[model samples]
Target: MKTEGGADAAKRRAGERAAEEVEGGFVVGLGTGSTTAHAIEAIGRAVDDGLDVRGIPTSFQSRQLALEAGIPLTTLDAVEGIDLSIDGADQVVDDADAAAFGTLIKGGGAAHAREKFVDAAADRFVVVADPSKLAARLERPVPVEVLPDAHTVVADRVGDLGGEPTLRSAEGKDGPVVTDNGNLVLDCEFGPIDDPETLAARLSRVPGIVEHGIFVDLADTTYVGTDDGVEERQY
Candidate 1:
């Protein structure tokens, strides 16, 4: 859906803030999703401006976008210890309690596994989003990435958690959506996530589950863009 007041403008604001937070010879962790497209664009501009940055994109789509943006690309073999990651979110809550330990919820593009890995590896993860994406509570469903062979198994596990599981499918595509890692994505409809950190921990213990979209306490800070201006929340 097209966002009001121009989503591109919001993305540029958040991307600029994300760029300002990084430094020289940095290994950047990039995220997927439309909003993040703008961040990638900004990263390319940063490269042009002589910022020494190389990116590790979270998804194939993100990688292509990054390459198109003219940002230098590298792999984990080339650079150890990512300096920072900047990504967009479907919903973001910057409460100190929620983001204190680099936790968050992402994966609207079904790239949760890589997003989680990148977040865990980064020293700082900056989530960029428009102000409207903030939530009073994490009431939306969490997306879970699972092995294709374990779809039923994982769905049963999620059901035990009082959630209904449905395989996520792309537009006009049949069957479950497969991630870059060749896993299936299940949308777990848990009405409200009271304790995101706890839920994230619990999901980690589930067998056949590659990664859950509930990013708990991983976000060091969130840069929210609004029509009025941009704001920051430290967690």
Candidate 2:
């Protein structure tokens, strides 16, 4: 495991490596999180160096970062498709039941809903992370965005699926944490997920589930920063 500072440096290195994949005239899907923030900064620098690209940010924070970086912004409706998406993950698991690239547990920032949308819209989805985030098995709880009115119902349904569902709370606010899409988040713990693909499919069927954080089969590749160097894994 890496220390805090080492992990942060690794993240930046991973982001910088992923940024190398970008090209002129590409419509990139910018992801959220600290690792992705490094990518945003690198992309901004590229723009200053005369690279022409448009960014579709996954969150308000990412949008602001892109704006500051001088990267032109566009909406999904304004673009035909995203050339690439660079993002981070809370955990990356090598599960036999997952897609060839494995599975991801995201939404720590509560932007999984939008992140999923933009990621799927992209031609390629790339994950950048530090070595500490990788695991033999995923242990993080899945984040499920739900409509406020369906919170209780969704919790019950998730419980039926053998998950312990807990509503995510705001850090500085009085109530539950609400997503940018106006939905509440349910952090569902199904310890050591055996089949991420099936789990993601099942979660989608829950009536109130707007989007769940089990990013099954979406990642095309992952760039991991380690003490030695950045390693690239293709799914």
Candidate 3:
């Protein structure tokens, strides 16, 4: 039977497995979200145990976690290339595309823009998630970050793309949620996305759209945490 901490344990299993991918002298792209936080903490523990690696965090939250974990961080401007990136996904889709390794929807924390930039630069990008994240198709609302001035225009363009766009509001604060880059977020619902690339392309063409959460073919491998154990899937 699953304990009260079952979900957390599953996330931890997957996260820690991804942490094992980090090596001495490697520059890692730290991912955002609670699941990814486990990996960050694990990496921190490894750092305390003598791992010599630097981290490039995807968001403020990730940066804070990495700092707490004692994982040294460097900027992209300071690095030649990233060795690996460990990220989390809102949804992971198993598709039939022979050309693609993995398809994912991310940015639930409104950090997708930065996450994509870091993940794409990695020599190997790994996703860490619990089994609940895996799915047959992408069904989550895509988070789109846009310049504050272009919010209205981008929202309209998102509607043109057949997505219902809503400005993402903060939970505890009064106003909308803002990105680390000081941009606003639009949670766009287009329903089950059959072709994420096409949608991503469409979203990208919209001026003021910094980045969207539709991450297609960026991951090389995934560690999925199940109730029974951690499962490794090669993409």
Taking all chains together, each candidate's TM-score versus the true structure is 0.91, 0.95, 0.95
Tens digit per residue, CA lDDT, model 1, 166-190 = 9988778777678889988898888
Candidate 1: which stretches are off by over 4 Å? Answer: 1-4, 95-103
Q: Which ten residues in a row have the lowest lDDT in candidate 3?
A: 93-102
**Candidate 3 residue-wise lDDT at 185:** 95
Query: For residues 1-235, could you state the per-residue lDDT of candidate 3 as single tens digits?
Result: 7643588899988999999989999999999998899999999999999999999999999999999999999999999999999999998875546333378999899999999999999999999998888877888899999999999999999888899999999999899998999999999999988778889898988999999999877889989887777888787
> What TM-score number comes out for model 2?
0.95
Which 10-residue window of candidate 1 scores lowest in summed lDDT? 94-103
Q: Report the number of backbone clashes for model 3.
A: 0
Q: Give lDDT tens digits, candidate 2, residues 1-235.
A: 7543577888998999999999999999999999999999999999999999999999988999999989999999998899999999999975445442458999999999999999988999999999878877778999999999999999999999999999999998799998889999999999988778888899999999999998977999999987667888778
How high is the lDDT of residue 111 in model 2? 96
